[model samples]
Target chain A: MTLNWKSGGVLLGVVFFLAVALVKPIGVSTQFVIFDGILWNAINPDVVTTTADGFTSPNAYLAKSGGKYAEAVANPINYSFIFVLAMMVGAALSVLARGGLSREERAMPELWRSTIGGSSLKRYAVAFVGGFIVLYGARLAGGCTSGHMMSGMMQTALSGYIFSAGAFAAAVPVAMFMYKEV
Target chain B: MTSIILAIVIGAAFGATLDRVGATNPSLIGRMLNLTNLHLMKTILLAIGVGSILMFGGQMIGLVDVGHMSVKAAYIGVFIGGLLLGGGWAMSGYCPGTGVCAAASGRKDALFFIAGGLFGAAAYMGTYPAWKASGMLDDIAGGKVTLGTVPGASYEGLTAISGDLLGLAIGAVFVLVAFVLPDTASRSGGQVQPAE
Candidate 1:
């Protein structure tokens, strides 16, 4: 059974607290970069190389911070990378424990049908495009909601607050435009 | 090894919490942003608020290390990127974290989202130098600074106020908003059905 919004909200807060207090703040977007580095390194071995100091890459971005990103690429089984993979595994297990995806989950969502009024194919395409834009933006910003917004704000970081403001400044307008009242 | 195990445990818990909160559904996210439903938004704000209180309080009592805190450098790109991310988030129901979780929950559409994210990340990597040259990545507004001074942390504070107290105040506000907010701001409503 799903949690009511109140309980779910508190639970999510606790999970994030544990993550920050114990090891580090929760983040997922950087793993996306590491994933790309992994794939690129696999295709071209020269992309990441062991240097006298540490791992280095031909790409400037990968080579920054003393090739830390390159090191993750060469050895993909690190904390952040594995954490991302585990998130998927965790989601899968949660779904399985509840039996499986429900009919409403597996099918097109009701809000989508009533508001957007499109086939599932259109939804998928829009979802894909949306994901692409967000990831690109996340990389550009060097963080996503979990990192800059959630974790940043929790830490009282000024950047986090700025990013959150910027995010909502755009998100609210876009959502209103897209899902106008019938 | 311990860190690896912690990663798995924490990641799993994080993912499960996301699913339980209905974040694995795109439509729910859409509803939240559109103000048709605020269940997910309330959950997110509450979580952030509580987490902030625990973390800052833990830091004050010496239970949590300030050294572990990471402060990303502020830049023009971050704000611009945030704007773009917000727009995309409104359009797509998934962000990086939720997209992967949604795929795991067996949404075929989420798979496409993940693929798109991968491609988008790679594109950023390819164009990194250009963006860097454009100065969007340059530090702005006391780069890597905090709202208030946090003891034992390296980042400078914009003010002399205690960071811990400031965090607590903001966290309380978030919690208060979460509690006070209606389930739906839409005039058409009763309790809007959750995406479930």
Candidate 2:
């Protein structure tokens, strides 16, 4: 494949260098936190604020970010949210440039077809639910794979290693069950 | 507005690079997890390995900030969350970051996944009080601690080393593992070949 480990790794490494040089760190989950804060602020601004000095969030996990969510919600045009949206633009350009958009986007693996069958709705539903669960877990954990595993692990943070190990432990078995049909 | 523009520039490059690497491909992700195509894992390790070098190495040269380096709280919630995210990844072939890129790549399933993730976030926000009161959110290992500063975590009762040194050692291991992993991965799971 053109996008093999060597090629892909080099591309990501460059991205990382740019991210650190141009930004503080690279991560993805805080985008969701900002999403939540925006929604809540729209509904009731009272929920996220505590005092003049700081603001509060419903999830203590976000609060642990040292007021990141509060600031993202209040200002809404900061580094994390911008980084998140930029990722989308980056991906879209890549697809269009590579003619990936022209290719038929199909469910991965025969497992998706043989088991789930030809139901677009089921595919969507599964993706949606999986998305929801993962987002929830990511918020609770204070980061996602990119936020913790990628950025934090690079710093040799303990949580990064633990999270990586835990994720691999659960993911490998679940994948075997899904794919092997065992 | 400056930050927004910067974000767009940076984000565009990030998204494009991710696509170039096939990080947006669900089949590749599934195969990696299946242990058939070890390329994806190897790629991830390489990225992390190299990133650690740049980050810590940069600090020594005054290019990066050791102070600005944010270490997450070493708590149990993170582990459980990682497990769920991992399972979600294996099941759906999309994690939070990759899912966004997938959506942008125009995969309908990925778009729906993003919507689902949003709905999930809203649900979590709605139930925040009860969840927080459960005390799981309380820091267990006590406030932000890195691998080099954890209180009880130990390897043979040896104390932690400098974060930079640890970063280097781990980076080396990742680099070695990425190079050594076999290129072939079991494709027993599907009919779809690697994207051309």
lDDT for predicted candidate 1 compared with the true structure: 0.86
Alpha-carbon runs more than 4 Å astray in model 1: B187-196
DockQ per candidate: 0.76, 0.61
TM-score of chain A of 2: 0.84
| lDDT values, one for every candidate | 0.86, 0.73
Q: Please report how far candidate 2 places residue A154 from its true position, in Å.
A: 0.8
Model 2 agreement with the true structure over B78-152: per-residue lDDT tens digits = 888888888888878888888999888878888877888887776666665666787766766544666554222
Clashing pairs in 2: A86-B11, A90-B15, A90-B16, A91-B15, A110-B190, B36-B185, B36-B186, B37-B185
Model 1's DockQ score: 0.76
lDDT of 2 by residue, A11-92 (tens): 7876775676566568887687678778877888665777577766655544645776776787777877878888998888
**TM-score (C-alpha, index-matched) for candidate 1:** 0.95
